[model samples]
Target: MKQSLTLSWLLAVAFFAHSQSFNNLPVNTQKPPLHGRHWMAITGKPLAATAGAMIFTKGGNAVDASCAMLAATCTMWDVLSWGGETQALIYNPKTKKVIAINALGVAPTGATPEFFKGKGMKYPPEYGPLAAVTPGTPGGLMVMLAEFGTMSLKEVLAPAMQMAEGYPIEAQTANSIERGKEQIKQWKYSTKVFLPHLGEKREAPNAGEIFVQKDLLETLKKLVEAEQEALKKGKNRKEAIYAAYDRFYKGDIAKEFARGCQEQGGLITEQDLANWKVKIEEPLMTTYKGIEVYKLQQWTQGPAMLQTLNILENFDLKSMGYNSTRYIHTLYQAMNLAFADRDFYYGDPAFPPDEPIKGLLSKEYAKERAKLINPDRNDPNAKPGDPYPFEGKTNPYLTLLEKWGTAHLHKPTSQNPLDENFLEEFAAGTTSVEAADKEGWVVSITPSGGWVPACIAGNTGIGMSQRMQSFVLDEKENPFNVVAPGKRPRVTLTPSMALKDGKPFLSFAKQAGDEQDQLLIQFFLNMVEFNMTVQEACEAPSFKTYQMYSSFGKHEKAVGSLTLNSEMPAWIRKELSRMGYKITYQDRTSGPINAIYFDWENGSFWGGSSNHGEDYGIGW
Candidate 1:
């Protein structure tokens, strides 16, 4: 019900924002992309930003600050649930090492292709307990703190607990609740928690109305209690932190998760919960103009960004002119190629039929793939390239995307066909947080899973993830994304870190799904090629292609669909249209981005946020 109304509401809100920013941005003193001296933190909410800043002032490092911010934001944004998925990339300057955390949960012990194939489910249901996997956000956050944070779990989570206990949610969050009001009704516990006092249904809260989630507060407190009890029993802080992690994945919470899944006809079992563990691996690195860009391994769309950058290096972007017809066309072609490779090759490492990261990231493969681009007109299709010998082995395509029959692969009137407005609403919203300390310890994390479709694990008041839906039911020829027990679906929740001359240069993250890497590429170019500031790069107009199959529901591919930000010049818009590119302009499709960069020349730290989602950044 609220999603239906959000389009009109968001438009009103966006119009006011654009109007104000447009009038004052060029000379807007007290502008966005705020800077800090010794440190900086940027998050989706100002309150969450404060939580991180408070941790930093308390002598905590970037890892500590990130935990605090993420926990607080989960409290503030209904779109960010404690039981959601999380992926983070952390860089430690002293060790000169970067660790990638894959906190995304796996398919349940019983989630095989049998049920989905027999049921003829082209896509799984969006809102329900049956759609969920074991929740992982709580576990992931604890692991991060235990390994890299200076603060204890209890100390870091104080802010979030306080908010859940009692606080007034303003207009923005209230709108999100309104958006998912109907979905909340679809689940038993979700409705009980969100609409407890509202009689038959949930009503949107007005600004300044006192809001409370006592159950959620209790859930958070239980984790703290478990940790404190372990400490009392002679366990050190780190052991106690691990105790909390074990409690979430192997103890009482895990039991409840299994019980809820069983009752919901879901595939998860207690064993799956106990067996689930997040992986902390070294980053997958690729070079771009002498800088080392790092991303998560095969399970994410991270390499697609690397692939896009490699292809674009073959073209002189500055000479083509930024946002020009040729520039946009070239970008579209490169992105489509990368995405084709992504759909054909990318998959979970623990699962077979996944892409070979080493082969895909090789410069030689990029050089080979660069030859596929056409200069004059848009080609509304994606023909995947060979990424074999690079990965040590090869698997032929399950079904050629080109043979799918239409130049426009999207079926607008098909079941569950999503218009742009509905598509945005269905985005399974993701949030990003970034923190950097004077020691050069930097972390970028994208955490998400909300209550809209997922259940609150049986009275635990923690939302669960519908991440299992990210997999495909391809049983025969495709291996990249086929469903099976214990497989991690190909996720779009990728964070990035980079080095310039072997020194930490940039740490950033964004909230878009498959479109994330595309936006990240454009943001980097805005800075390197155009010499724009961190703030300028974030605020610059951006574009993305939907020509590649999306990572979410039904794997829909809107071929040749080019979505540009409304802020672009009119001439460029017309020029793009003239080239037969299926173009549409609205607010950003890649969503809001946030970053913290080191200004080497000035010997200062600079920070910026897209601020499109009411984000905030602080540096000091």
Candidate 2:
């Protein structure tokens, strides 16, 4: 108990110092993330960080540590679980290559935006069984291990499986449970699985309560058994790993999942599970200030960060003063422009190209788009710039809908602010993790889904995602984000890496729904442009704009509006307001922005986890 108090006191002191800064120079009162000569693992939760470190002690690399940490995160139902979505960018120094893993569940082959619209629903429903997609977390993790990890499934899963049976619920996890308690009560399995405390007078477990998820334990045990069986059959390590993946997607677990979905009015069948496969795409790469930045494609909102950087690269940011009114204004306009293009053009690879997205990431195209930003005014309704000249003629979806009259084929717009309530329903709270070994192997992952309104697979205790709600109900107007069978939604769960001169320099992710990349971009700039340490860069004030349609349901937006952290100087806020920015106030706390930095010159590592909630960065 005394030890806990000391840690809390230290963190409180750190956060307070971080909140105040002068002239863009840190006051040095804050506690920066730890630097190490060996391996490091930073996670959304401390237990998961410990699990990853456990793997490192076992001589496992970052790929192995990441897998262990991811599984450990699944032990509790806060932001991630076995039924969640997992997307990652893995860096292999040996090959000098980075790979993208799109391991998210799809609309259950029967899902179409029209189907929901036909049901008299303008926006897709948020809660209940009908909202679920086929879960891919288990399969994704197994697959990642099979390809890059040297640890066995039995080894990596040990920590997660044990914790699934019982663990002291952390404060944030408990709060998340309370947030979804009402939804949990609507489903018997979810109630029994996640909110067992409901059997008592409480709605959910309180922090430090001994919460146990027996079904998850059993499910993980089944996966381990499957891998062991493969070994008994003389299978190699990789093949044993494949056996574990198959067990989750095509074996008994799949059967249980299909049955659960069917009972809940979902359309996924045994076939969908067997047929589902995660695509490994080439990582999206671009050069920023001579350094290479990498991300997932438009399937996520990842490229928007790169696009924002490309636009900002045109100006001398150092002269603007970090977090100054000039800097904030320019950043917001750049983000608004990038997001406008994202709404118009980014979408599933399965869809026919209206125009090459490559052109959207081009420097010349960003120059053209940057011209649209006005110094004296903020555009209430920013429209996508034409990258057609760079890629060719404009595609059909480019001009699909302008004025929403007949083009107003989808949900009617309410005068209400583009409330994130729509995003609240679809996106499960998410978590990001970064792990690295001494050998330079790096892994960054964002695990999502299985939160409130999660569908537990009957008695299996495994949760399933509702990511399908991210799809647009209007088929015609939203050319890129329209719901379709076998198509992944344009999810906001993007994890990223930035390379300095073609070498790994930084890796990071945020969990603020569509605002993920917008927040992280500032962190990137504070480090790259201003040379702030990891913690100082992250703790700096943030500014955001809601001027574009959200990637989530109903596609709501607040055109021309921007929100600045209230902690920013009042003078700067007034200056921004005078510049015609629709201004609002928000908290400036960091966390939900976990990151790690590689200092090649010193041959060391620095890990930083946002002080928000229960996250921690530990290294050796």
Candidate 3:
């Protein structure tokens, strides 16, 4: 008889403490210190990072541990999984070089803007042409292990496969599962894994319930066995790794994926799958107060960091006072300038020409742009000023809504105040890892994709990013965010690393769409200028203004007022209001932010996670 999973999965609230013991191990002490050889830090759900730490302790290198973490996260935290893209910035102390792995997938070749228009779709359709993309997490992880790791695929995948086959669903995981249940029911494949038997009458599996993904485990096993066989043939590590990629992208697995896409209205094709290759590009680098900062390129909002940093360079942030009106206004002005440029120029570089980064980051350009800020009064209808000569030549790409003809450039009005009141609720999510050896090599990887309605396919378990929602509708533009062939959608996943005295001082990452770059800038400033500890820097209350989306579009610029976390002083809010700034106080809870800061003088590691998440910063 099939086991009755109902009773086994139902967990009582009183048992929460016990559940946490298994799931929420103390972040700092969960992993025993690694001797002189290696030390690593990971931020995600407590259980998932612990699983990865175990692999590293058992002689696995960074790549081995990262892959293991990815697989386990897929099963344990389906909200963020392997079916999504994994962008990373890895530094090799031996070579003293930084290599970026662009595991982000592309829109399938079969996709076109017209596909969505033909479907009579508008901005946010449940799921159709807009949702299709080449899932890249698996492809990216496999490549990293094959090229840089010391363990085989089988060993790296063992823990995750075993967990998926039989592992208890903790309360946290169960909560996410329950929260996303409605969306999961919308997709056949997602329902099969998350809501297996009950169909429309499905319910969430409770804590202590054994949540299993038999299909995902079997898929992992195939890749593991294939990787081992390749290694047995006396093939070098690199060749064995390539075999793993072939097994997925160009091998039998590709055929299965292609068939699934075809049946589901997904745009992926055999040619798209076979032609896909992860890109290796130099990260956008800049200097802030003699310290070097690096971020992913234009394919993401990575360059916004440079623009913000450039603007802040002109001001003495130290003297502005923390969270003060002057401080917040300056930051907002800098952000607005950066965001304005982002709207006009940021897009897939592979697309037609856009403004080059050099002009955007030019010192003169930032100075010219910074002059536009008026400290006493808010520029209610601020737009991107002509900082660079080319800024004038580039016309704002217009997005057309289905009914609305063309988006009109409207000045700021009471209809859309800079601080329009919306729901002030708290929400958070995760995924970040930091590792460094005594040799000075460091790796920081932040993997992210939205939760629900955007889950990865069965066995693949990759969560497709819903990042395309940020694209605005242009007037007369039939459908907005229409998935086009070779168009890289705007991404929220930005990983950052900072070097102090020619060594890795701080490796930080977080998961908030437009907030990613903004938060990074605040944290970096907190540390470098204000001289705060990692925990203090992150713990400090913050606020953000979302005036525009950083993708190509010409929508009425709506300035959403500053939403300050409650922890911020009331005086700060009053000061902001006095400056003609709209203030919306909100619950300050934020997504998990993980960081590993090296104490060069002490020769030790210090790590911390956002208090809002159930993650611990594990390091030794």
Top-TM-score candidate index:
2
Candidate 3 global lDDT: 0.64
TM-score of each: 0.91, 0.92, 0.84
Cα lDDT tens digits for candidate 2, 1-620: 54553354344333433442223443441346777789989888889999999999999999999999998887766576677788999999899899999898877766877688788876556555656677888888988899889989999998888788788988777877777788777777888876766666667888898888877788888889989999999999999988978888888888987887678677878888888898788988788878889999788888988888999888877666667667778888889888877766777876654436878998999998888888777766677777767876655554454542232212314453334564353233578889988898999998887765577877778777767767776645456777777777778888999888778899888776777888889888878766777866666556766666655555566655667765566666688878876666666535368888998899999887665556676799
Report lDDT per candidate: 0.75, 0.76, 0.64
TM-score of 2: 0.92
Residue-level lDDT tens digits of model 3 in 284-337? 888888888888877777788888898789897766665666777889878977
Worst 10 residues of 3 by lDDT: 5-14
Best by lDDT: 2
> How much is 139 displaced in model 2, in angstroms?
1.3
Candidate 1 residue-wise lDDT, 436-547, digit = tens: 9888789999887754544666777777786776777763214677877788877778888888998888888888677688888888876776566788678666787777
Query: RMSD for each model, in Å, please?
Result: 5.6, 4.6, 9.2
